[model samples]
Target: MDTRFLESFLTVAESGSMAEAARRLGITPAAVAQRIRALEDEVGTLLLSRAGRTVRPTEAGSAILARGRNILRDVRDLQALAGRGSIAGEIRLGAISTALTGLLPTILARLLAAAPMLDLYVVPGTSVELYRQVTEGDIDAAIVVKPQFAFPKTLDWHVLRSEPLIVLAPERIADRDPHSLLRSEPFIRYDRNHWGGRLADSYLRRVGIRPHERLELDALEAIAVMVSKGLGVSLLPDWAPPWPAGLSVAKIALPANAPERHIGLVWSRASSRIRLIQALQTVASQVSMDPIAG
Candidate 1:
């Protein structure tokens, strides 16, 4: 397929008019029309159907549009690979909330220091959303964690080893009788939909350690605050940011059946940025040294 023709077709799809597409491409409307005609002739299909002053895609046009975006993405990747420019481009990364505290600093601090001219964009969300962004090529890379994490053949996921979940409580809080205290007070619940939350929930279920669900909270700091106030008991990753003042560690035995979750960095081959991917891998390797933290 002609690269020029694909470019023109995409421009038309974006502009929804041959004249507009030609204007954006800095070419005559006739030239743009010729490129589309050339593309349609090669494909042996009617790609677009006219609708008054506007244009709409035929069934074939919609299918070709999808492929065209992918083709453009590949072209961009190739150009980057061939370029000799410094690592000065924008790198967009999405991370789970708490993961950013340690993991991102380990990775991005180096990147920013190495490439002072680079523009860094960091978006924090749940792990599941980060996975979607990577798959869509919307972000360059992401850090994902969960027990059932598996890579599709088309995508890639690198494990950073398992991070054990630990219970954080007050200094004198009931460590062995967490359930007893929970029944007496409110039990702070982490967001069950998140990776940490779900993993903690799984452990609770496996051990049959049920607490009265008083509060459903997500943020680690917030949970620590509630726990410090003697509101409840909570389970969290042993490897976490600093706890609030007065908060203490509450050790919970790993259930015989429940196991620690493996933390990983996942990226889509379709969207992986070489520098961003490398930075993430380097950080993961460094963090793997800590046995308690994920």
Candidate 2:
């Protein structure tokens, strides 16, 4: 089976449009359609469901999507391994929103400068989602909040940053006690669905503070904006900077024992791109040490 055909199918499935897939693959749309048709014939099943401009994977296609990704990854790994001691080939990296906005640009810049042949494809997701992606071999590695649970032996994790939880309040109320403000003021709750947010929730529970709940969402920057506008105070990780500018908010310190949100890198132990992964790790370490990165 031609891997190019498989690539076309996966790209089409991901983009939900053959034209878009063709654009990404640098091929004509008609050629992309032909490749998909050939792949469907080879696989002996209809792989996509088409409706006007939109496309979706059929049941059969969905079943094979993960396997297809793995196959392509292995092929790429083989090609990279054949290279003459140079880090070359794509790295499918997943990152949480904060890491994407905060640390990723520096890491990417240094990695590319050191290994000019390397290519990158970045996926933005929550820590939970990125962890799952790494475990499932969908991505080479991820920068994410550390998981509360233990990981399997197939994966390796390393802590990159330890962000402490803090009370985010408008400057006007910055003088108020953190716990008292949480209990008295309207609360903009961090989403407990995310690992970082779970830390905040666990802290609130441990302190026995049932805040006057006002609103809740996952985006930390958005939460900050709300706090800046005096919508409510929030408990959040003091995430790495480049916060939205002109926000008049204060990061009030939590108690000495407040649970910290650990941001880290997780990767598959079995990935053939270990050199590239190690290079990325090194760059992340350098960035973490840089005072301006915070």
Candidate 3:
């Protein structure tokens, strides 16, 4: 059976009239009818029945239509795969702002050097938004702090880095005991919905330490800034001195307990970019291990 005839027959069945299908296919109505007859002859069965100006599928037409749809879908997929042999298109990668600042550039540079034709588009958003985009297939993949949320069973996750959490206090207070620091100051907590926030909260609760009942904020940089101002103590991954230049890092160790933050790559198992993903993963692991991320 000719695939062209199957396409014409399918189009007629969908549009319900030869005139409409021909108009859509930019063919004459008589040509559409001829193709339909040829398809019927090949199958040795009637495909469509006329009802005034409209057409309805016969039993054979319904069967052929179902098979034709599958055939067309496979044809389109084959075409797509054929054209996707090169990594020469835009790649939209999303990450948390912190990750964007810390790790994204490194990965993008590696990706560009390896796949020169790829135009990288970087989207910086909260972990929650990035997770949704990854789940919905809006983003090709993501490099964000791991979220404490339900992931679809179809996704692949890789733990790229596990960063040690630290206490952010004034330069003068850096040497003080962490328990005393946490107890004496209003701990400016990050928003609890983020994975990092929830992880910090869980760790604090487990350490038998309670943050002062007052201040809370969301953004990492903002919390860092507040900690620098001596508004309160904050706990975050040990990356750098917080804002307000004079700030410094002090590592905190609890009895048999230490808080950790995870950064990782998340991608769909059904995604078409597996080779590119593997390449990115190879480079990303290196980026994750860089001393700058510390």
Candidate 4:
């Protein structure tokens, strides 16, 4: 069977729109339709049904979908094992911007060196967006903050790092208490929209400190820069190293009970790219333990 046809069919099934699948595969909608027709003809049954602008698999298509995925996975596994463990395929990975800046470089270098034939496609997004992409099968894996609530049963998470929430205060501030400083000084808030930011917010609420709000921003380095200039104090994670340079700010630890931000890799358990994800896990393990990440 033609794997290209199976892949096209799978992409369309996942996306629910021929146009969207075509965009993902970098092919025309007409070409996608032609391939699906060819596949259906080869199978001798209607594999899909058109519903307005979207498409859905028929009973036969549904029956074969799992089999088709297995076939694809087996083929790639055979190639990888037979070729001295050289993984050769395109993998789309999504990551939060913080991971892109702070952690992904070392992991990417190691992964590319191990599998030179692999084509890596990186998509930068927030944790929420990356989680959606992983769930929808748009990306094989993602590096993001672990959700506070229960995650879907279909996914697996591997914790890479746990960073404590910290207070960033200007050197001029004499106050040592995180809560007191927050209540007294102008606050450069970490944007509450992010998962990490939510951690900070929850901690603030628990500590009963309503900060004197001055600004709400997302970028960690930018927040560090702002605090360094004596703009305001902000609560943020003391994430791994390569921090913003020459920042004259004091990093104050929160009370022992404050929640730490957990960062890790997340992926669908049924994905065929298990080997690749394992490779990523290996690299992340090394990076997390490395002094540079601290």
Candidate 5:
């Protein structure tokens, strides 16, 4: 069977749309459909069913999905191992929202400059979901908050940055005490569902202060906006910023012992994309070493 045909079939199966798969593969929808038909003929089975704009794999296609991925990965690995061509292929990378906004662009620029042929497919997701995707091999790697639990043996992690937690309060508050303001003012609680949120929660508990909870949300920028509007003060990591413009808020430092939120890359050791991951790691390390000035 032609690898190109198999690739097209797999792409269509994953994307659920021939047009989307064609766009990703840099081919026309007609070409993608032709490739899928060729693949179906080679396998002597009906592989997909179309409904409107979407396409789903048939039982035969479903049965071979994992094997097809493995085959394609193995072929790519073989090419890399043989030094047959330039390092070029799609890399699916998962990342958290803050990292997407704050850290990744510089690092990505460096990586692209070094490997001009490489293609990156970035998927934005929460840290928890990114970690799961990394472990499950749904992505080549992920940039996310350091996981709270013990690391499993199957994955490797590297720290990229350590961000200190800080209190964000409206500038007009007369009292400057971090703890006092935290307790007295209405609190815009960080959503407890996030790992960083849990860290903030732990800090509050350790200090024996219970905030007057007003609202709980996950977006840092939105929370900053709310605080600027005098809604309530918030506890958040002083993550890399192009913080909201004209926000009238002051960042109050936490005590010396406050937990730091560490962002890092996590990847499966068994992945075929180890070389790409290594290249990304090098770029990330360089970026971390020489952070860009705001």
Candidate 6:
């Protein structure tokens, strides 16, 4: 059976929309449907159920899902193994938004320079999503905020940076107490759903400061812009820089004892792309040592 067909089926199943799967695969919807039909034919089972625009996996499809992923992973591993001594082939690397903009570019530049044959496919997501993807082997590795919980033995993690929480406010309010500003000003809250955001939430609770919340979001750079426009004050990690330029915002430092947000690399220890991942880790380590380098 054609693995491409299986790939198409899995993509469609995950996305829940044929058009979306087609778009992601860079193919027409009709072509995706054709592949799905062919796969179903080969398997002698109906693999999917469709209702309106949404597509869901049938019982058979659901049963085969994990095995299908493993099959594809093994196939890719064979391809990478074919290269043997060379650090080549694609690495599906995920990163949170801040790391995507601030840290990944530097690491990618150095990594590609050292291994010109290496291909990188980057997936951007929240730390929570990226962590899940890494755990499930949907991606080889991720740059993300460190999870509060201990990692299972199947994975490995390395700290890249430790960003401390800071108050983001307009220059006009820069002089006010960091905790006081959070209580008085319209607060542009960091989304509590994220690991880093949870740190901010914990700090707020510990300090007994309930912000006068005006908005809640996950994007730090966008939050900086909002604060620059005097939309409200926010509490966020002092994430690696190249922050949005020309923003008249101030990053007010919290007390020295405040909690920190640790960003790191997380990857499957069993990935066939371990060599490439090691290369990535080396470059990431170098970049982390001198964050301003690119």
Cα lDDT computed for each candidate against the true fold: 0.71, 0.90, 0.74, 0.85, 0.86, 0.90
TM-score-sorted candidate list, best first: 2, 6, 5, 4, 3, 1
lDDT of 6 at 141: 96
Query: How many collisions between residues are there in candidate 4?
Result: 0
TM-score of 3: 0.67
Candidate 3 structure quality by residue, lDDT tens digits, 1-294 = 777688789889977999988886678999999999998998899999999989989987897777786775455445435547775554557888777766777778887897887655566777788888787766668987776666779988888777777777766677788778887788888778787888888888877888785577778787776676668788777642223344453456543457677888998888666556666788888776777654
Candidates ranked by lDDT, best first? 2, 6, 5, 4, 3, 1
Candidate 2: residue pairs that collide: none
Q: TM-score: which candidate is best?
A: 2
Q: Candidate 5 on 54-119: residue-level lDDT in tens?
A: 799999999999999888777766654654255576678888988888789988998999998787
Clashes of each: 0, 0, 0, 0, 0, 0
**Candidate 2's error at 267, in angstroms?**
0.9
Over 4 Å off, model 6 = 18-41, 44-53, 58-60, 291-294
Q: Between candidates 1 and 4, name the one with more favorable TM-score.
A: 4
**Winner on TM-score (1 vs 2):** 2
Please, what are the lDDT tens digits per residue for candidate 4 over residues 143-199? 999877888899999988888998899988745788789998899998888999998
Give candidate 4 regions above 4 Å deviation: 1-85
Which residues of candidate 3, in runs, are more than 4 Å off?
1-84, 240-255
Q: Looking at model 4, report the run of 10 residues with the lowest lDDT sum.
A: 77-86
> Model 6, residue 4: displacement in angstroms?
2.7
User: Model 2 segments beyond 4 Å from truth?
Assistant: 1-5, 15-46, 51-54, 63-67
Superior by TM-score: candidate 2 or candidate 4: 2
